[model samples]
Target: MEAGGWAAAYARLCREGGAEPQQSVVQQLRARAGAGLDLAARSLSRDTCGALGRLLRDAAPFPALALADCMLGDDGAKLLLHGLCSNTTVKSLDLKGNNLQAVGAEALGKLLQQNKSIQSLVLEWNSLGVWEEGFSLFCQGLSANRSLQRLDLRNNQINHEGAGELAAALKGNSSLQELDLRWNNVGLLGGRALLNCLHSNRTLRRLELAGNNVPSDILKAVEQAMDHNQDRQSILAENQSRTHVLSKEVLSLKEEKAKQFLNLMDTIDRQREEITRSSRQSSARVGQLQEALAERHSIVNSLKAKLQMAEAALALSEQKVHDLGELLSTAKQEQATMAERQAKDLQQQKQEAADREMKLLRDLSAANEKNLLLRNQVDELERRGKAQQDQLFQLKQDLTTTVADLRLRAVQAEERLDMEKRRFKQGLDDVESLRQKEVDHMTQHMEASERSMQERMQRLEAVRIGLEETGAESGQSCSACGTRPGGGGVNQSPEPGQAGGATAAGAPGGEATADDAVTRGGPGPLLAAEAGSRGGAGQGQPAEPAGGESSAAGGGAAAGPEQQGAGEGGRGEQGTRGAAGAGWAPAGRADSSGRAAGENCSPGAADESAVQQPPRGPAGQGGGDGRSPGEATDQGSRDLPDEGGGGTARQLPSERHSGLRAGVPAGHPQPQEVTRPRHLSLRRCYRTG
Candidate 1:
């Protein structure tokens, strides 16, 4: 009868060609759908395949659906899956090698999420790797499905990354019992992740990943995990049965305990009645004890009052003793403080006195040192004065000697003039006598000789005057030109008229000035020579004054003649030399002071002054005393203040002239103006001076 019923249901399902099948035919075809429907290797048209989907859906309790190797494509798979919405009867779905691709796989995955009765799924060789969405959606659908117990995904191009997604989905899937991922592209990593997931997965009983790149050990682990899962499931089933038995025993024990509780409640009521009667008797005895206690309390209060009075007396005694001790301590502290304060004051006063004594000692020492320095300075001043006096004496002696020489020369010059005058007078007499004789002879011999005779007389007069003038110039040049020790005298006779007739009185005024300068510069040496001469004369008989004059003139004239031959009058030349030499003495004096005091003052001052001064000539030469006049002037300048910095003193020409004249002795001839004869200006000679 069952075979007949199944055969009729199959015939009915086949005959129902339209999408909307009869409800009775769907119920009759349910048994055949559960037996398994294989549509592999078929070339069903699109309309026929869609009609098959309606037939399966109409069968309310369809159990399995297989369309393997049918090449149904994604459209056919989607149409067939529409019959499995909210399906609870289908246990297995086999779509292996159907060329479903991603669209078909995604549709199937969504169907799995909606269906709760699917226990196994076979989707091998479906090209699930063609689109990642298919594999991912399928994995997600598996996570929502709790009733799917078996999965077959062999040779479906599932790489390690997709395999990993499947492994992650299995972590939450408790109902999936078997998984097939054999002959796919899953590597060792995906195999390991699946192997690890199986360790905690209690429900998955079988996992197949053979003929893949995964290691064999991972496969072994998967097999062991499946075995372990099966054992856990059996154990869990036993525990559930045990738990049910224990729950029944606990309910029976609860009822037995409730009966004992009711008996205990009845016993408590009887005990409470006996306790209440005993409490009433105890309450009466407590009242009597409280009365006696009150009497004892009053007796204790009386005794406490007496004890308080005694304690007060003892406290008053202690307070009085404490006050006495405090007063004693305060008096001792005051005495010690007074003594310490007095000691500190005494020590302070002693220290102050010592400080004052030390200060006085230092002051005395400083005053003594100052006094010693002043004494030394006074001694030095005295020594300087003595030295200056010696220099002055030497200069005065030089002047006196030169004066003697000049006076002697002047006498000789007078005598020679007188001799020349007598000679000229005799020559005139002779010429006049001869002319008279010639006139008398010519007049006797011929007439017309008177004019010639007058002309010859006038010529003779002119010749006499010229001879007198020449003689006067020679005598003046000889007298005024003084001799230097190693060089010539200074003469100004070549053109005396150029000096505005300074030589009008038969003497070269400029040359006289030159002679004075030489005398002042070399006074010591020349005077020493004059002193020797005078000494020699005084020691012996008197020397001839005439011979002295000739010797003096002859000695000085040797160098003068050459210099005089160069120019007519050297008044201008002599003026410059005199001006330069005038300062030379003083400047040389400053140079000596610079050599002495150069250590005390800045050498810059001395060096700058040296640059400004003119170069020294014969005037800088030392005298017979082996001391240049510069030394004397230098010593004198030291006594005078500089009045200007940088070793140069500022003084007007007139002031300097007065100062210089004041220094000169009364015996020496005083120049009206200390200046060059050419311009008569009081010219400044030396800044260092």
Candidate 2:
């Protein structure tokens, strides 16, 4: 079947794609170059394996093939790997960008373990979501394949866990010098794991993770690790230098020791004095030993020097690589910042462009709208450019002021809130002062009330005493019955202005006038004196006990002139005030002045004053009106006597209640001010010695 099958295999190869080898025939020619055959970049989106690989296997197999980005995926890759395993071809392979998930990876991994020809592999962009398990399997393949030097799985989504597994593989894999898994969505944690692997893995020189959200702190840590890496390199150099110096010193010492041994041999011969004959022999032996020492020293030194040079070059290369890695990371960070800034600008520009269009649409009519739109587009572009220029300047100023003001406000608010809290606490601490204020106000009110009540009582007492004395003095002179006043039956009555006499209770045809309502006693002393001269009996209090006449006199005494006098005086004054306020001041004597005032006078002022503290008694009674004829006398006897009364009944907790009712201090609506200063002025905190 070799010759016949070859013909058939060649037929499929040509019919499918190998017929046109004009453009990329180098791949086909390489497959038939005798040393080895190869065909790559087949770009066969369909199944090109049976056509190509079968033909190659029939004639000769390739030692290398790179089918990168050829869309082989799992099925195609598996078929090729299985066929190639039997073919004894394909030393180096590149299956990059084939959508080879776990299926293709498994086939390739198995083939790699068994196949010895393959030394390098690039499986970049293979969709291996197999994760850590997939990496482990790949590592297993690497362990089995002794010839493999480089393996690239770059741009694969193998995360931190997978990276860790790869790191462990790199530790044992001595042959692989380059392993790139760059841009594989190796997030910060994954990137860190890979970087850690680099520390102990001397063979791996290149690693990359250009796009990732690596934290600044984590990057700093990596930088520190890098610095440690550099330190380790320096320590290694020093150690090598010390070794070199030790080697040189050892060589010289060995030479010196050899010379000493020869001299010792010579000295022994001379001490014997018999080896004079063997001196040339000793010299020749010494010469041979010297030559051997020189050769050994030269060889050892040459090897040491070469090793040192290699080490130095390796160190230099590693330094450069390290520098490049750092630069790459820095560049990546800078690039990300620049991209973000640019994105913001682009968004703003787009918005500006949209606004400009809207304005043009508003300005133009439908007929010319289209033409206007084009002009608007150009104008918008120009506007955007100008705005962009202005944006930088405006943003600089706004940001400066905004940041400064915000910082100042925050600090000032903090200070103000703190001060307010302290003040509130101090106010709360002064509770005793508040209580004392309430007590003092209560005391002042009580003292003033007591003085007013006492003055009224004293006047009433004097009137009563006068009534009793007059009863004693009258003693039944000019007798008439003790009849009720205004009864129209008895004809007994006092003369006009008579102070000592009293009208009987039932005096004939004598009616109480409006003025008589307030007359509880005789006329006042001054008015009575004037009246007494006009009448007789002389209005005076007498000290005697008598009969009917005396009883009538007793009535006058009880009516103690001053009582009527006080009530009349109050009424007269009230009338006077009412008259004055009503502009009735002495009719024609400067009456015009009074007339003007009456217009401006306040009405009901006289009534207001006359109505005593609580309000005057109602027309018939006192209690209902909350005031009595005298000092709020209670008709129902609800009031206590106006005596000590348990020393004012502990100031009537109700009075305190009344005072509090005036205004109880509750939580206040505080007006708070927050100040923000442009500058923060902190005083130096000095420590007193």
Clashing pairs in 1: 149-177, 494-568, 494-569, 495-568, 495-569, 589-634
TM-score each candidate: 0.33, 0.29
lDDT digits (tens) for residues 161-248 of candidate 2: 7766766766666556556666666677766776676667554444444554555665565556556655666677799999999999
Error of 2 at 249 (Å): 22
**What stretches of model 1 exceed 4 Å from their correct place?**
1-35, 38-41, 244-689
TM-score of decoy 1: 0.33
Best of the candidates, lDDT: 1
Q: Which stretches of candidate 2 lie over 4 Å from their true place?
A: 1-41, 45-47, 50-61, 86-91, 130-135, 214-689
